[model samples]
Target chain A: MTRAFNFSAGPATLPESVLRQAQAEMLEWNGAGASIVEMSHRGPEFMAVAAQAEADLRTLMSIPDDYAVMFLAGGATTQQALLALNFAAPGQTCDYVVNGHWGKTAIKQVGHYVNPHVAASSEAGGFHDIPARSSWQLSPDAAFVHITANETIHGVEFRDTPDVGNVPLFADFSSSIASEPIDVSRYGLIYAGAQKNLGPVGVSVVIVRRDLLERAGQPRADIFNYRSHVARDSMLNTPPTWNWYLAGLMFQWMLAQGGVQEFARRNATKAALVYDAIDTSSGFYRNEVVPAVRSRMNIPFFLPDDTLTARFVSESKAAGLLALKGHKAVGGIRASLYNAMPVEGAQALVAFMRDFQQRNG
Target chain B: MTRAFNFSAGPATLPESVLRQAQAEMLEWNGAGASIVEMSHRGPEFMAVAAQAEADLRTLMSIPDDYAVMFLAGGATTQQALLALNFAAPGQTCDYVVNGHWGKTAIKQVGHYVNPHVAASSEAGGFHDIPARSSWQLSPDAAFVHITANETIHGVEFRDTPDVGNVPLFADFSSSIASEPIDVSRYGLIYAGAQKNLGPVGVSVVIVRRDLLERAGQPRADIFNYRSHVARDSMLNTPPTWNWYLAGLMFQWMLAQGGVQEFARRNATKAALVYDAIDTSSGFYRNEVVPAVRSRMNIPFFLPDDTLTARFVSESKAAGLLALKGHKAVGGIRASLYNAMPVEGAQALVAFMRDFQQRNG
Candidate 1:
């Protein structure tokens, strides 16, 4: 059966091949006499699964030897609070770069632990572009600088990692983690909630530098203490074993599909196809973001007539494009083209958009 | 194919029937083009799944209207800290009844948020018996009292819920939740990590009374806040969707098997077979826990001579019985007969034990 292309921002689409492989192994995992979900986390079978997952992810990201890969629970929202707990202690402050809805939400959530100083914000620009690095007013005494590398809602992204001087840099790459090649050494911490380009929901991947883990020496913090997780190898508690197993399968799939470099080319091609359709539509189908900061992962666009928005989503769904409805905060339509979304799906969406524009205009 | 009888503590054993059903619907669930794992959590399909799971659980436990059932991420270990964060605020004390390894671990983790007072403990008794209720030093002004209804490792269980007067009672029923009928009104909060009898390891079920949730009006408790989880219907964050779906299936299966009442009878029969073997072993096999407080879920026993322990586990494996090794902290054998373990499995274990005793003794 031909699978419909899913464009959900999260809890999003996964590779069909990966799903088939998981289905085949649902009952018996390689003659282990039990499914991976039924295996104990402390058992040797699951240990190998966990170890291989971390190793494959490390190799794919070209992660430095100094960085420790940790698989945790809770989504990116939990990480927003956890980052504050681990990096900024009570009375300490952190620099935050607000580019879009996700950045603003991060600031609001992290404000509970530390005073979040807005280093730079693009809210004045209607979240269409990132604030220039020179305009950022970074605090010298701040614990770290936080940024959302790609904003899923606004369809904006930072093309390069920002240098925060002596302060450690942390990025919530929830939407863009595996889409392109990245220099892992540039950031002290990188976290991605695994609903997007990774595997499934419920498991979060965190890459933390060793030195930054030392800051988690706070007396009272419980689950957010990075040191505790690092020491126990992310098994300080029973992890979301099924999600971790799925993630391992995803990593293996990514490797088989020519790794990150190949993924980067495909992502570029898919994004360009959709962007080209939007560009050719003139004022009919308009994408708000500036070309320089537009995301390759998520593309948000709108029709000239507000009434046409609902019609567009309904028609698109009928045409086998799902989850095309934009986030409520950003009205119109959003097409999230993650790693699992094939280029053919993007071409189909572009073709549909072109046909809709000709008829509506 | 005949499935092996698995007895690993958690992420342990699931009903083979559940696995078969899950395998059948792995790619397309009920003619829905998407797998349950692939569907959006906010979609109507998944909403039905999440709602049905909560409804089934409520029916199984006889939960009242005032109590909210939340399907949350993180295991029971996270709940230990979360319970302290929600109920036991700073400067307040929470009482902990330590019966075994899990109880002690909960106390140590809860120490991060509040002063955890060890109201009663069985560690002094080699963790083989539940502490007498009369010996407990109940604190009048305590925020809440915590207990492990069934200790998976030490094989000790509270045969009956303790009366904590007006202080709210919170029990971690990780290993015992679905094995028997539980009175929900007696406790203010009850949580179970889903690896045992529920489903998988990614999701934890939290049932909290409305008034107890009112106590969690703090500013920054994050995902651990029970009120926030209840307010959002466990969708405060993207929950462990697949795990929740799997848990719902297990709940349905339990219902088909005649709910917790029928489960209790089957559990009693299963526990009796192993315990009876130990009782009639005539100095060959011995169970150390006091009979009145012995667990009907986990049966931990020892050989008369310690030298045969390795042989016992190895021969059991050869006979198609797996994971009979005891927890590292408790150096003996433990048979965890959660709801998924049928009477036939328990009988097989008993038959294996009798044969081993006849040959080795």
Candidate 2:
């Protein structure tokens, strides 16, 4: 079967090998006598799988011993609230660098827990470019400086982690995590919803510096507290077991493909293919992102004729490319080249783009 | 191939038909040429799935139109906190009926959000039976009266929903939902973790009365807000999609098997086989739960000698009955007969138990 390339922003594509392995072991896992989904989280069978997944993820990112890694429910959206509720004491200020849709949402959600100060925002520029690091107005009294490392909707990405002196830097690495190598020590905490580059839906990974644990807010609710989950090894309650197993499989697959460094190299090559086609389209197509900060994971392009948009999406889908429709907030076309999207998928998209441009232009 | 009977408390057994259907469509669904996991939640394909699931569940429970059904993240433990945060204002009194382990946990967790009132408790009896309805203490000003419909650990079940006049009743039905028909209108809200009868882990079902939505507390965070989830059709953010898909399949399977009425009949028969074995054993095995209040879903029985517990679990495993080791809080054997457990599985356990008692008694 010639499988369609899925370009969904989330609940997105996963490595084909991982899918095949999951299919083969749907009912039984590694002769454990039962499926991973059917095993209790506290049992040795599922515990070993969870431990391996955590270990592999730690290895892939070279996570420091000072960090506590937690697999939690709710994606980046919930983390938006949890991060603030966990870190900020009542009336404490938190800095947020708002660039795109998710970052803006983060600012609003976090406000329910603390006073969120937008240290910098790209709204004035239509989110085409990130605010320069030098221009960021982080406060010395802030508990943490929040940043969306990659914006899936507007296709903007941060090239480097911002340095906030004496303040812990928190980042939502949802879309860009594992796309490249990262330094664990640079950020106080990092969280990613595991739908795009990771594995599947239902689990989000939170890695926080151990020191930050001592500074968590006077928790209003036990379930919202990160400290409790850390104390119990993220099993303070029954976790999403099957998602954890699949994520472990993903970590193993990522390691087999030479870790995130190799992913970085391949991602760059894939991103360039789509960008080159759009750049050379001679006004036939346009990508609104500032070239310097364009996301390698998501690329949004616009056709010169608005009427051509529907035809492009329908035809591209018919040609075995799927989920190319842009987010409703940002309309045009979006090709999400997540970690699992093969280089061939990008090349296929470029070819389709060129064919459409030639006939339409 | 014959599959082993899984007796784990949760992330537990699933109907064979559900597993087979999931495996067959692992790569594609509805001839869409894409896996259901690959479908976008907002797209018509997955929407149809989400819609059908909601409809089937509403039909199964006879949920009134006034109730809003939501598929959420976090487990029942989280729901304990959410129920308080969403329904109770600061310092508002909420009554929790603590009959067993889960109820006790709910009382403690809900305290994080509101002043919890223990209307009735069975701790004096060591969680052996439900407190009679006449013994419950009522609070006219309570936010909601909470109950654990079925206690998974203690093996005690409420034969009927408690009447908390004027005060909306809330239930954590994680272990007992879909095992039999329910009167949805009696409760203001019901939430269940999907690991038991529903399917795998990661998603939770929340059925809230629409009128109750108007009384929500000051918003703590958008993602945790029940009102936000209901307004957006529970797509407040990317939900646990794969779990949702499997749950939809389970609901379809339940409907095919004559709905909850059939499940109730089968479960009662299964419970009878295990209970009868212990009752007729002449003190070799004992179930401390009072006969009338014992749960048909979780039946915990103790051996005459505690030293034989491990051997019993090992022997049960070898005999194809898995995860029968009781909760550490309650030392014994616990067989969880969810909707998926075949009647023959219960018979097999009975036959094995009679033999073991004869040899060891």
* DockQ scores of the candidates: 0.62, 0.68
Model 1, span A1-361: residue lDDT tens = 4467888888888898888888888887877777888888888889999999999999999999999999998888888878888877775888999999988878877665788899999999899999999999999999989999999999999998888898999999999998899999999999999989996888999999998887753444456677888898898888998899899999999999999999999999999999999998878989989999899999999998777888899898888888898888988899999999999989999989989888888
Best by DockQ: 2
Worst 10 residues of 1 chain A by lDDT: A216-225
Distance from true position, residue A16, model 2, in Å? 1.3
Q: What is the lDDT of residue B46 in candidate 2?
A: 86
Identify the candidate with maximal TM-score. Answer: 2
DockQ of model 2 vs. true complex: 0.68
TM-score of every model versus the real structure: 0.98, 0.99
Cα displacement (Å) at residue B341, model 1: 1.2
Interface RMSD of every predicted model, in angstroms = 1.9, 1.6
